[model samples]
Target chain A: MDDARLAELYERYGFLVHRRCLQLVRRPEDAEDALQETFLRVKRYGPPRDGGATLAWLYTVAARCCFDLMEKRGREPVAEESQLAALEERGDGSTEDADRRALLGAALRTLDGKTRTIGVLHYLDGYTQDEVAAQTGFSRKTVGKKLKTFEDRIRQLFAGRSHEARR
Target chain B: MTAPLPPSPRGPECPPAAVLEALSAGEPTPDATRAHVQACAACGAQLEALTTGRDAFLRARPADRFLRQLERREAAAPSPWRRLFPVLAAVVPVLVLVLVLGPRLTGDGPGVTWKGEAFRVVVSRAGAEAVPLAQDSAVKEGDRLRFAYESPEAGHLLVLELDGRGGATVFHPFEGTASAPLAAGQRDFLPGSVELDDAPGTEWLFAVFSPRPLQAAPLLARLREQAGRAEPTLTCDGCRVSSLRLRKAP
Candidate 1:
């Protein structure tokens, strides 16, 4: 996309990209940083396609940017860990919902960069399987396979964590 | 003399992804595909995966307020003129002035104003009336407590009850999901009353408000060990912590 087009894309999908970033990083400033970084990368390297494909492509880029930021922060995202620990201390392990989120976050960390991006786009960002496949250059079959694999792994992780909490 | 058919798109097997998608969307899977999934371990696993992923999706929410904050950041991003064109040097002083004076004028410095009054942890018992807690209010073990709050804007709320001796427990998000949503300008309470456990002393209660959900486990563990020495009030990015003190009845 050209400069005018990039500007237009930014205006049209700014919130979309930002939303994905926030879901991953959970910090407003970090989310903003990820948003700026994603667009900057887009501006530097042209988008994968035009029209509706662009949104999927953008979602993929935003997911990667957010994960990259998470990776750069090391093991767990600092803000999320800090906040999660704060909340967890206030109770025993009976908070099943919070544990599930913690479990999901931990499970996500186990995925490779590409798989994590795909999962975030499809699951958290609510992209359709076709859209994820289109953005990631995977066949719909492969996307389906990967998503299934992700689910199994996350469930296992959640189970282990819950078991540990019970112990 | 019949036209040859193009290759079959369905082939001998159904596309596992399409079937999983349909299943996740709550649509009926093709009968043949469902039968195939039941018999094929790989397809069955895929279906299970889709189920787990959809569950996560149901729990997840877009960080709307934070996304808007990012848009604001984009709008306020440094203009190209400031970076590319030296000819606009005259605008530099004004930019500098705004940066230097804005925080001071707006009270946007490090301090975060805690809105303790916005939330109340009312305590009562089976035969008694409920009253908003005041600092040092005496309460015995088994006193039932419920939280009531008014949020200035839609946000996530986390309540932590800190035993003055250094233990903390979460109270607001009673269900224990990532965070609980509180609508702006409305008084809300936990769906049920929480009975005070055996931990008895001058306990500190903290109510944390954030514009979006937060994963706060790490901080909770840290505070559990250090809460006794920590100050009653604390602040973090996008979150404001408010406090109340209560004493266990002697």
Candidate 2:
């Protein structure tokens, strides 16, 4: 795409991509690096196949870039609770909301890489089952099944917390 | 009093997770799924939670330094034509002259004699155009010698000059010298103004067409030593040698 179109794409979705990167990388600096790389790759390879899928496509690219960066640092894919808490303390979000995100991120860590990617694409980022399957190369039936299991696990986690608080 | 929920048969509550995702993505939901989401308070609360998380994440803006770096990348990329223009400027005129005069510069014609070798050469002075050199034709120092010639056959060409003071100069194919290939019947000039220096006496010009490209620098270096000792004997394999003498005005 030309610079005008690229700039327009960046203006519209750059923050969304940066946010996704920050969520995965858990560091603002690393997230910024991931955001730059994601747009550069988009410019080089052209945008996603479907223009409507721009945000979803950007989500996938940002996640992979963050994952690769983490791997290069010889770190695990598991979210660092301390770093997330530190970033949350920066006041980008409310403490309660940050706590909820930290819990959700911990929940995501419990899933395998493929399942976690599928979860992020299907749930928080709001891609359809077919779109998630297309991006993750999973069959729609498989995505439907994994998402069911995922939702049940979250429900159980919250239910057990409720039970413990009640006791 | 609580309002009644919209009437619809919900199949397993239509997967509230998918409905929530679709809603947040601004995708159209199945009518049944929409009905269930409207009726179910638990699903509605979950959708709000997901939207809150997504929106909060999107609040992070791309830093200013990143945009500036992209602008710098665009500015650093060189335009393709800019790199090719100078090469074209130097090559086009020689091509044009070859195309315009190729048919007329036959190697056999009235020639000039020097050291028992005859070579056809057309000479003109700096303000004179296409004036053929004749007996007693003389030019002063600082006057440009506009000489044109062709080879009898296709080969590598070199024009070497020996001044009256026995200094050897390579007059073709060096830096700032532009000429054409020695294809039979292809006419070319020694590019640009080739002015005569103040060595006032007889000067010999030799044009050699060789089967292979000659290295003029080393040959000229050796010629300089011989030029100071005696009349230099120069040789090249499969070379056609021709010569002319020009009178330098005293």
Question: What's the CA error at residue B59 for candidate 2, in Å?
Answer: 5.8
lDDT of 2 by residue, B30-54 (tens): 7877777778775666566656655
Residue A10 displacement (Å), model 1: 60
Evaluate every candidate with DockQ and list the scores: 0.02, 0.04
Clashes of each: 22, 0
Chain B TM-score against the true chain B, candidate 1: 0.53
* Best DockQ among the predictions, by candidate number: 2
C-alpha lDDT values of all predictions: 0.62, 0.59
Superposed model 2: Cα runs more than 4 Å off: A2-16, A82-167, B1-22, B25-36, B46-250
Interface RMSD, candidates in the order listed:
17.4, 11.7
Say which candidate scores most in lDDT: 1
Q: For model 1, how does the per-residue alpha-carbon lDDT over A15-109 read when each residue is reduced to its tens digit?
A: 55655565566677777788878877776687756433455577678767876777787754333455455332111122333434443444566
Lowest lDDT 10-residue stretch of candidate 2 chain B: B1-10
